[model samples]
Structures are given as C-alpha cells and as structure tokens.
Target: MAGPLLDIEGLNVDFLTDQGWVTVVRDVSLSVAPGETVGLVGESGSGKTITSLSVMRLVPDPPGRITGGSIRFDGRDLLTLPERAMRQVRGNDIAMVFQESMTSLNPAFTIGDQIAEAVRHHLGLGRRAAVDRAVEVLDLVGIPAPRDRVDHYPHEFSGGMRQRAAIAMALACEPRLLIADEPTTALDVTVQAQVLELLRSLQQRLGMAMLFITHNLGVVADVCDRVSVMYAGQVVEVADVVDLFEAPAHPYTEGLLRSMPQLGVRGEPLATIPGNPPLPWAMPEGCRFHPRCPYATDACRSGAPALTERGGGHFSRCLRLAEIELTGAV
Candidate 1:
C-alpha cells in the first residue's frame, strides 16, 4: 500500500488553565490515505474537535500547546516546520470546514473575497482569476447562481447555503486533505443529507482525503470507509465501518452502537452507556472507560491497555475486550 497522505504519531495536546496544565489529548495517532474518508465518532466533549484542530496546528495559544507528537504530511514533519512554511501549507494543502459556518466566515468580507484570498495566496492567481475560480468551486459544490451568490456576504446566505459556501472555500484550492469538523451539526436533516452527498461527490471528483468528525453514527455509516471511536481523549477502537457496526471490539464502541434508537423496538428503552466522559483535567488512571465498563476487571484499573490488533486491521484498546460480549449486556 502507498504511504499515508497524513500520519500522526504519539500526538498529545495540553492546555494551561488557571488550575495548571492539563492534558486533553493523550498519545493519540491516526492517518488518512489519499482520497480516503475517515470518520472520528464520539459524543460531545470527547476531544473529537480538538484532535482536528491539533492537526491544523490551530490550537489557541496562551493556554493550549502540543507538548509531544509528530504530525507528518507527505513524509514531512509538520511540527518542526517553521511557522511561515506551515502557514503556506494550511489552506493550500490541508483546508478545514469548521463546525459553524456563522462563526468561521468573516462577516466583513464578501464570501467570494474570502475564498479568492485563499486561491490568490496559494495558487498565485490574480484577483479576477481567483474570483472566477471561486465561483467555479461554488458551482461544483452544488450552489446554484454561483456568479450572483459569490458577491453576497455570508450573513446573506441561509444556514445550509453558508455551509456549502464554507465547503466551497475549503475545496477552492483542491487541497490534498480536508478536515470537516461537524460540518452538518446545525443543519436540518434534509440539508444535512444534501451536504453529505456533496462531500462524497466532491471527494471522488477531487481525489482528496478527508477527516470527518461527527457524533452521528448514521452519518459515519453513510460516508466513512473506516471509523475511529474516541472516548475520554483516547481512541478506543479503529475498524472498517461494517466491522465496527457488526462486531465492535471495544466496550465503548459497543455502548455507542447500542445507544442508538431502533425503529421496531418501540416498547424497549434505548440503550445507553453509564456515566459521562471524564474531564480532561481529571481523567481517571489506567483504562478511562473501565469505571463504566461492565466487563472491566482489576487489571483494567491498574494499567492502560495498548491498542492491539484483533483482526482484519481492526484495533482496540481494552484489556477485557476478549471477555466482553457483543450483545452489550453483561
């Protein structure tokens, strides 16, 4: 197989709060192949967003810092790269469509201007050429009347339209990798479906890899080729989407799957995982999910489990993984 387009190893991120330094992401690692769509799924506050921000080296300063890790893009170590060089790579090589388009877009600038700036900077196109290319991208993302809407401000567009514009900007330069952090969070179901289908079509057309982060399992199954389940700042399991749904290896993965409401099981209560994710500053020792895992044993309390390969490229980080039944009931 070809090398990964993006490779992250031993990645750790920390924030310096009034209470002192606290680790938020711990020894996490993941990769994306060229043109592959990988989903990062977890409940809210499970560190999914932060992980994507870390990849872009966009973690806010004065508090957060990447203490340890190697972020390699196309075999080049990004962490060691100079800030000036990294800046050139950001929007050019790895662009991101943030969760909220309302907050991400610049209210002062026209949507076309914002995208044109990216294209001009990266592709060295003149103002008129960049604007033309921006409109072209907007059309590619299924935004009708691209010529007319290109000059409109972000606030002028509806919620779903704004998201499509944001996505258009991210794809303006045909980036090698795109990190979409909850791209459809605020949209209605119909709009969400449209945006997801657009992304899938664009991915195939552009031949670009994607790191799609979302809490929606249904979305993961629909778009992702592989899924990585995160819990308490660590990846609990990584597997193909079918394997994950059919036979989840980690207890946390099982819990998440079981929690989804089924259509025919009306009288039965929806299954749920017990307890909340531990606070980043106060994460428990050893296995983070052991406290709530039904199959947890004494060993789980004393030592963190290594992410071991189970089979078929599936990996899990649970000592009692062998003991847990997929039925999700102890």
Candidate 2:
C-alpha cells in the first residue's frame, strides 16, 4: 500500500494571550492517505479547527503560531517552507471550505469572479479561461444555470447554493487535498445532508484526500473512512470508522457516541459528558478529560496517558483501555 498523502506529526500550536504562551493544540498527529477521507471530530474547544488551520499554515500570527511539529504533504515539510512557497501550496495543492459560506464569499465580487480569481492566481489561466473554468466547476458542483448564475452575487444565492459556490471555488483548482472545517454547521438538517452527500460524491469523483472537521459523529460515520477524536487540544482516539463505532476505546469517544441522538429513541434524553471542556491556559494537571470522565481514577489525576495502539490502527489515550469496556455507537 502507498504511504499517506498528508502526514502531520507532533503538531503543537500556541497562542500568545494574557496568560503568556498557552498551547492550544498539543502533540497532534494524523494522516490522510491518497483518495481517502478522514474525519476530525470533537467539541467546539477541542482544537479541530486549529489543527486544520495549521496544515494550511493559516494560523494567524501575533495571537497564534505553530510552535512545534511537522506538517508534511507529498513528502514536503510545510512548516519549514517559505511563505511565498506556502502560498503556492494553498488553493493550488490544498483548498479549504471554511465553516460559514456567506463570510467566506466576498459580497462585492460575483461568484464566478471569486472562483476565477483563485483559478487565475493559482493555475495562471487567462481571464476568459478562468471564467470558463468557474462555470465548469459550478456546473460540476450541481449548480443550475451555471453560465448565468455565475454572474450572481453572494446575496442573490440561497444558503445551500452559497455553500455549493464555496465548494465550487475550493474545487476550481482541483486540489490534491480538501480541508472542510464544519462546512455544514450553519445549514438546516436537510441542506446539511445534501452538502455532505455532495462532498462524498465530489471526493469520489476527484479522488482527492480530505480532512473533514466536524462535531457531528453521525456525519462522520456516513462520510469518513477513519475517525480522529479530539478533546481539549489533544487527540484522544483514532480508529477506523467501523472499529470506532463497534468498540470505542476512549471514555470520551464513548461519551460522544452515547450522546448522539439515536433513531427510534423518541423522548429519551440524550446522554452528555458531565463537565465542559477545560480552557487551554488552565488545563488540568493530568488527563484533560479526567474531571469529566465517568471512569476516572486517582491515577488519572496525576499522569497523562499516551495514545497507545491496540493493534490494527486502532488507538486510544486512556490508561484503563484494558480494564474498562465502553459502549459504542451501535
């Protein structure tokens, strides 16, 4: 089997706040094989978005920075690359569909123009060629009347259509990897499903690896081949979708799965983790999830457990992996 297309190792991101430099993303590592989809799932403050932003070298400076680790894509270390060289990587080799489509699209420019700008900037195509490429991608993403709608402003399009346009822009350059950060967060359930399906279809069609960042486990099960669960700036579990669902190793993973709304369980309250995620600067002494974990022990309060492999690419960051049996999504 071929090696991974995008490999991240020991990634640490820090922010300069009132409390000095606080690590917001700690020792994170994951990879995406060629033509594979990997889901990064976690609650809001789990650093999913920060991890994805670090890959593109898009973490804002002055406030945030990549303090440690390597981001390697296609055998190149992205962290060491010069800014100009990194620019070539962004939008050309890797494109990101951000959380909010409306904010992502420029209101002043037409949809076609925004896409064409990216195509022209990255691929160096002529204006006419870029416009044609924009039309082609819009049509490819299933937007109706592409040639005419291409001239429409962001306000002119509906929410779903705007989201599709953002995707079209991302796909215009035909990047090798796509980073989707909570792409369906703002849409209704139906539109979210449609967008998820569209993303699945596009990945299959383009044969591009994807890093899908979301808190939605149901969506992760539907679209992801592998899953990485993050909590309080660290990855707690990594497994194949089936393995993670059938036998969750980490307590946090189990909690997330159990908390999901299951079908045919009407009126039953959804399960939830006891406490909120800890703040980055004021992180706990030992395991970050210990305070909220149901099965935590005195040992869990003093020492952090390493993310250990349990054979067959399944891993968990729990000291009691062998001692406790956790329920899965199934």
Which parts of model 2 have CA positions greater than 4 angstroms off? none
Per-model TM values vs. the true structure: 0.97, 0.99
lDDT winner = 2
Number of clashes found in candidate 1: 0
Q: lDDT (CA) for every model shown?
A: 0.90, 0.95
Candidate 1 lDDT tens digits, 82-107:
99999988999999998888988999
lDDT for position 92 in model 2: 93
**lDDT, residue 16, model 2:** 93
lDDT of 1 at 221: 87
Stretch of 10 with least lDDT, candidate 2: 268-277
The weakest ten consecutive residues by lDDT in model 1 span 321-330
